[model samples]
Target: MLESLWAEMPDRFRTIDLESNALDTDDLTAFLTDPRGPGFRIRFGQLPADMDREMAWCCWRIAELGGRVPVGVLRSLIRWLAATVEDHPELSGSLMRAAPREWERSIAAAYARRNGSLPGRFWQENVGSTLRRCYEILWAAYDQRPWWRREVWDPTLDPRIPLRPHEPLGNHAVYFQQLEPLWLRIAIQWYFKVSLETGQLTWSTVAGPQRTALQVFADWIAGHDPVPPPWLREDPAGIRAFMLDFLSHVRGLITQSGPNKGKPLSPQRVNTLVTCLETFYAFMTDHRETAAQVLDEAGWLRLGPYHAMLWRHGEKGRRTRVVRERRQEVIDDTAFSQIMSNVHLLGEPIEGGGLGDEQIMRILMLVARTGRRISEIRMLDREPLLPLDRLCGSTGPADADGAFVAKLRYQQTKIEQAPDTVLVDAEIVAIIDEQRRWADQHLGPRWAQGVTPKYLFLGHNMNRNADKPFPPSRINQTLAVFARRLDVRDSAGRLVDFNRTHRFRHTKATSLLNAGVPLHVVQRYMGHVSPTMTMEYAETLAETHQREFLRYHKVTADGRDLPVDTRDLYDMLELDKRTDRILPNGWCLLPPRQACDKGNACLTCDKFATDASFLPELKTQQHHTLQLIDERRQAFAARTGQEMSPDNVWLAGRTQEHDALGRIIDTLEQTGHRTDSDGRAVRGAGVAARTDALAAEHDEERRP
Candidate 1:
């Protein structure tokens, strides 16, 4: 059998270069000598007829002389012998029987070497587990079974056998379990594959929480004895009840890990689990025609009812759910200044007390200036930077001193509709240039050879894989370490948390909006698909609103001075408390739940409050109202030959508003507030100078 298996090997292995050939005797010989070395291993040559038997006998001898062989040497020898006969089942069986005792001794010896003591009861129980895996690998190869196929779950199996508890069940192990319907199992696996291909889901996402939901659901069904599997074709009612019960149990159950262990899941987490389960049911129902062919109409109906229950439960649960509103955290001006002042000290020798890389500082700066997502920054391709001339036609920041600006292009993964290009500062472009030179020098010849992807932020570690993009976690880790070294703290006096790199994004967006950039412009800068998302990042600061109110209230559209103090104007309109209710012409102070009784007669209503800010709008309304009053008077005269008539009662109200608006406008003009050429309110020359002095005082007061 060994000879036949060897003979069946491809002819390419017979060559010296394994990359260009198949494995042969010479390759096997070289592999055994030094498996981790540079060159390809040599294959084995012709063997004696009793080779399998001889290997088995040698294994038995090693078991008897346990302490004679060092643990490491014994492990290597067993592995080498196992690989040699892995394709020969008869030989594998013989060696499996001989190696059990030897395997135990080797495992114990290896444990003692690491911990300086023998493993206790739990380790002892799992002693043969590694040896079992070796035998299983050989058996699996001989049987030609899929690599993921493994032993089915055994309820009585010792949970402690695997030393490491809480290990999730494998895909094959979960699918082969007898409790779940075969068709349902197949459908889920198929969905997982499709999702992975479309980038709609990740393997880790499906393997972790999705699998856990299914396992917990199955366990619940099992615990209820003799209840036909909840997924059974005849049990629509049972399935619906089981789903509701499962959700309730999940909601109330406390977590067993992380900082929040022993506390019930948050609304967000509960919602996530609900979504996961709902997705599974949705997939089944979406392909109902196919599923019915396999499980029949009864089984298909079971899925529909359960899906409906999940939808209704989610809707009702959300009504009463108290989802905590989380404020977007950002690095304030003080923290940003401090970070920039000390950032250059990172990545120095340990003697200088440096504990981070300079590369992270560059990344943070890029995020601050560009407001790009961390992932988008991380996955930037080899050549991301462009010259200002290349982007002459592109929308970007204005040029300064005729100097070249930098534009970066990168894919936006989160919001797919967002644009992929952004304007960056020349300083950031210099940083990228420096990184490119460094990568070329340090990343071997791959940069020059053009054989590998030239990631701008390549990993520097030599022990692990190289020439790959740096992990986002490493960037965050560097920030955390640097933050600790500086002892950074927030306003609350707690140590500043640097875990969220997204704070830089929020900080950038807020800064741009507060600097007077229009909302639509800021939206484009931040790569937001909608203005709403941009607004979330541009949450207005109290200081910003204060400054705007002070600036606007001191002038009128026609360049006249205002008679009222801005604070009194704000008070009259209740503007500070209800900013949204203030209109250009007047303020509406009515309660939100109440209806307006005066309708369009705002100027005539006592609830209305107007100042110089309303002069232009009031003038416009007065002109229109006066024109309508004249038309109504003419109609009344034409019909009744009277200047006033009951038919003109509506006109009487309009006349009152027209007169009231005219009086308000005259008062604003007398106080020196008037419109300019552009129709925007401006303060008179004397008032403008006084307003400037007051603004300077306000600025001085706000300074640190």
Candidate 2:
């Protein structure tokens, strides 16, 4: 790596001599006069006599560590390094010894001296980028410890994501050095234990907010007037006192950075701060012996039951509050239509107020059509589309034509055991195919062999091997700007906020349920680990429910069309919220204040009502009822050598139920609600006939 950087330098600059601590004056003169070096000597004269050699070394090291650097940036880097060592000699002798804060001050002072104030753009382009590159190299070289043992863990090097190095380190690096020494030690060991030893979490989660939470706790501890001790290892009284003070301290704190700066910390933020401490203490207490041995301190054994438990029942209610406050809005049909119609604007040039992204529109299309999580879609493997027959070893379910169906095995980034593969229609497959072609055309040569790129969507910068998936934050930011520019709004005139891509997941799930798809099927489609989690997305719209309810004629006990107004019946039943009113085969139409005196004989009750949505349940119940009647009649005949009387009480009830079920089924079949075993509508002539009837009815309604 250094060879490429040293190619343009003279022989003396090619290698650092092990015996010489500093470059000789002649060597420095050769470098400054070299045609390839920064072609100016104005700043060179200001360099400190004792530290100029070290400053020159930084310039060499940065070039060696980073990609091609501009001469201007190299000049700025030299100036920054020289000024830093002159002003803060103790912090600047070597990049390896410099701390984050020291480097921070060095850059600020250097830029301030030259420009009066540091500008964000110039700082990033010149000083920040150059320093980060040099420091990254220095840290990699200085820290010879195993990753788990180091103060900073770079998740980009993790084998699970082989191309993480192609992405920026700021997003993936976890710094434990900011913590107090003791807490740092505990945190390092705990992170190692959970993330590597036990495999409790993947780095995606452990390296993110969890790491930030720990750092926040560390900062709080460092800010205490008198340094705080390990109260978790202290006696019960000390533990209690420490926790009370910590909680109060955390609650009263305000945000110090980002969009929420100067505002009070949210309840969610407070919970995270407290929860991290609790998690840390709980882990230490559970594995006290291991922690003690690892930290080389017997004090860890003092962790007790008091340390193991932190908050009492109901104490951490902010999580519940967060759930309660969460707005899972489904992008309504009008909004969805508006977005899709103008989706081409997303790929338009940025000068035209668009994202100039080629992949985002396709990505959003996949998410909407498949109901997949954005991460799952973004991290899709290159060959995500598998033949349905290959995945299941047979043709798919009868309703799905296998040739037009494919299994999309997305990267399961969140829940471990959740379904990773979902059966997708040809429409979704076409989108994936389009993206795959784009990746292949763009990234084929980047792969060493004929192998495909690892991810369907590749990162924009430094992704030579196509290892890193496109950044998720890019999608969010682009979506936000797009929505604002397009002024996309719903039917109610509220802005359709598409920034949270998860809302597409919610929208898809809700749409499926309202379209009469079964809950368990939706659960599998949405990759939900539990039906309850899937339920969270099941916000059924009343208009959809009413439309579906009114689509088919409802029949009563004797197979006659119900006389009541369907809209009034819908309101009277409160079908959306009242699950008790919803029965297996049909809805029980008894008023909320009225008792059902008819008991289980709902089929015989005049108040029972149902339509096409209940056709599947009705068919199953009718089949089962017929089986029972036949079995009982056969048993009576076998015992007495005579057929059971139709008037017998048990026989009469069975006949009535079987007859009632038969009548309901016949009525539904007549109205064209007949379906296959899978509940999919019979799709040939019956569908065309119903379509024509619906059109005619729609025309009549329009006229009236």
Question: Which of the numbered candidates is closest to the native, going by highest lDDT?
Answer: 2
Candidate 1, which ten residues in sequence have the lowest lDDT sum?
A: 163-172
Candidate 1 lDDT over residue span 584-682, tens digit each:
675554666667776655555544555565567777877878887788788878998878754556876665566566666765667543323332332
Supply candidate 1's per-residue lDDT for 199.
60
Off by over 4 Å in 1: 1-106, 109-186, 198-237, 256-261, 289-302, 305-309, 313-316, 319-328, 387-404, 445-450, 460-467, 540-704
lDDT for position 382 in model 2: 76
TM-score of candidate 2 on Cα atoms, chains taken together:
0.64
Candidate 2 at residue 469, lDDT?
81
* Candidate 2 per-residue C-alpha lDDT over 1-704 given as tens digits, one digit per residue, 9 for 90 to 100: 22333455545444333112244432232232345554433233344542344434445543332223344565666667667777777754456556645676667876688789865775655566666765665565455565566666654433332222223232466666666756556655465445544666455556666777777667767777776555442568877777777788778888999768999888888887788778777877788787777676676777788887776755654664344422326788888898888888887778986678879989988887778888888888878877666544564553354344768888775776898898877777777788788777765544433334777887755454456688888888888888888787776588777877877887888888878888899988888888887676553455555555666667776776566776666677674447656687777767777877877877777777777777788888878988988999999999999999989898887678877777777777887643233322221111222345778999999994
Q: How close is every model to the real structure, measured as TM-score?
A: 0.56, 0.64
